[model samples]
Target: MSKRPYLIERYPPSDRFNHWFVAITFILVALSGLALFHPAFFFLSHLLGGGPWTRILHPFIGVVMFVAFLALALRFWGHNFLTGNDRQWLRQMDDVVTNQEEKLPAVGRYNAGQKLFFWTMVISILLLLITGILIWQPYFAPYVPIVLIRVAVLVHALSAFVAITGLIIHIYAAIWVKGSVGAMTRGTVTEAWTRQHHLDWYRKIKKGEIRGHDHY
Candidate 1:
């Protein structure tokens, strides 16, 4: 009988669920935020309901996105720390883009690009949360000074642009990397996929150094 390829669990069901939850909420929040951001995007408000409704729902949805992201961040916090290997991997960006895995360091579960993007999301979301509150109106903005609110508005818009840009790159990378989306959607990846993309992680898994199922 022919032997089947080995498979490895990448994300548990709970983590996958958490990640998808955040993704969904982020989409909603982004659309609603854009609607309130400019007249050009005002048409997007129809997605939530209308202008008045979009204004009301945007901040609430943003709160949900921030809280959900915090949960996801805490879960993956340990994996994202920058290391010497990661820095080296980053320095060899040309090799990475050219599929020269053998020329680069054996990457861990997350690569340098991923770690940097993770931190970008963290900082951007924190800024969005703080600034969103400052300009929230009725409940909070009324008590805040106008000058501070003005500053908060500019910061919030800039933060949102950063976050949206990061997310676009993140999505593109996921698509660029074969089998990456499958790791999250199916909660597993083939042994070959792991070995090629995250060789250090694969070695750790083989030695029982990391958590995950490895079986045929």
Candidate 2:
């Protein structure tokens, strides 16, 4: 019998669930938010019922997204801090885009790009939550001064733009990098995949410096 290919677990089931939860909530919130943002996108409101319902649900969904992301952020917080190698990886963007992995630094479980994306999501989500509250009508906005609320609206839209742009890149990168989506979906990646993409991480796994759900 052919032996099963050795695999390394990258994420446990809980982390995958946490990731997907935030992703689902983000889609919901983004749709509803866009519907409320402009007349051109008003048609998008149908996804969440209609304009009024979309308006009502948008903030609530955003709150849920923020909470879910917070959980994920806490879980991966340690993994995202940039190191010297990570900075070098960032500086070698040409090698990255050209798929010259050997020319670049050995990447960790999360590369510099991935770590930056993680922090971008964290900052944007936090800003969205804060500004979403400031401009929230009929609840907290009424008590706030008009000037601050007006400022909050602009900041909210700006932050949303940043977040949406980052998410697009994140999705594209996931698709561009073979086995990346699988690492999240199945919570494991082949040993070869790990070695090629994240050699440092692979070395640590071999040395037992890092533990995963399973190793073979």
Candidate 3:
């Protein structure tokens, strides 16, 4: 008989639900926003109904995504703060890309790349929200100056580009790093996977220094 792998708790059910909720809303908002952005992507409007419906719903979906992301950001903000070890880890990008994690600094719950991505998402989303409001039709844009509205449109597009790029990289990394998706999907990870990817976190968990609501 094969030995069963030991499992470690990662995200709890609530966290996973929150993550997926944000993810779904993001997809909807991205598609609708794209439909409004360019004629090339206008076909996507059909997914939500038609161009008129897409225009009406995009901002509302964005608001929901923003609120959901706010809750997620608060939940994981503490884990994402950069540290001296994280700096060292960042300096070892060559090792990280080459599957030489052993040669790099011990990783925490998030690696340096993940932390940077988190902050990037935070900034991008904030800019998107601010600029989005400035250009929002019927509700807010009419009160804003035309010059600022133009600038806000530019900023909104740039922010969306950065965020979409970051999201692509995030998805690629999740797939490239085996077992990462399971943390969000199943809300747990194999002990061996945790030890290999986030050794410092694994040690803390083993030492009872990082107890959560869920037990391993």
Candidate 4:
């Protein structure tokens, strides 16, 4: 049999651009945030222009990351809807972890873990946004009560930590699965690659549409 070529643009240029946009802003926010968290982490402030600037820019960068991520997320959330099949896939996760992938169910475009990450991220991001706004000073803090701001700060910190942890997992997963990074890097994946990892998605890509995972 002739080898199938990798042809579909899995991420497309727009998606890749958004991914990088979120990535850079996330890094900036993380660094500046660490600087504000404690004296030991104050060295990170230097990257943003010393102590004062770090405080000024950290929230700004975080806002940028949040908006960019929200845009990217809205585009992809439909495919991530959970279903009976996804639950079954979760049950077979051990086979997935063991790389006995052939023994597991064929997911459309994303596996159970990927879908879980997607949903978890969405919730965490929403929490971060709402909480961040509450604690945001020179903006809404004066209008809001001090106790509410304190509560918002606690929620914001917790949600940011969760979102960051999920981001690390998302990145690590992209790296772990060969050809996965190619989707974000070059906006495409080989036909063979798509077929091997997401047979149903490959069929749709071959058919010329840019969507998959038609959940019921």
Measured against the true structure, the TM-scores of the candidates, in listed sequence, are 0.97, 0.98, 0.97, 0.89
Model 2: lDDT of residue 18: 95
**Stretches of model 1 off by over 4 angstroms after superposition:** 214-216
Tell me which of candidates 2 and 4 scores higher on TM-score.
Answer: 2
So what's the TM-score on candidate 4? Answer: 0.89
Ranking by lDDT: 1, 2, 3, 4
Off by over 4 Å in 2: 213-216
lDDT, candidate 3, 53-169, per-residue tens: 998999998998999999999999999999999999988889999999899888999999999999999999999999999999999999999999999999999999999899999
Q: Sort the predicted structures by TM-score, highest score first.
A: 2, 1, 3, 4
| Candidate 2 residue-wise lDDT, 95-198, digit = tens | 99999999989999899999999999999999999999988887899999999998999999999999999999999999999999999999999988988999
Q: lDDT per model, in order?
A: 0.93, 0.92, 0.92, 0.80
Runs of candidate 4 exceeding 4 Å displacement: 1-4, 207-216
* Every model: Cα RMSD to truth: 1.0, 1.0, 1.4, 4.1
Candidate 3 yields a Cα-based lDDT of 0.92
The candidate with the higher TM-score, 1 or 4, is 1
Better of 3 and 4 by TM-score: 3
After aligning candidate 1 to the native by TM-score, how far in Å is the CA of 120 from where it should be?
Answer: 0.2
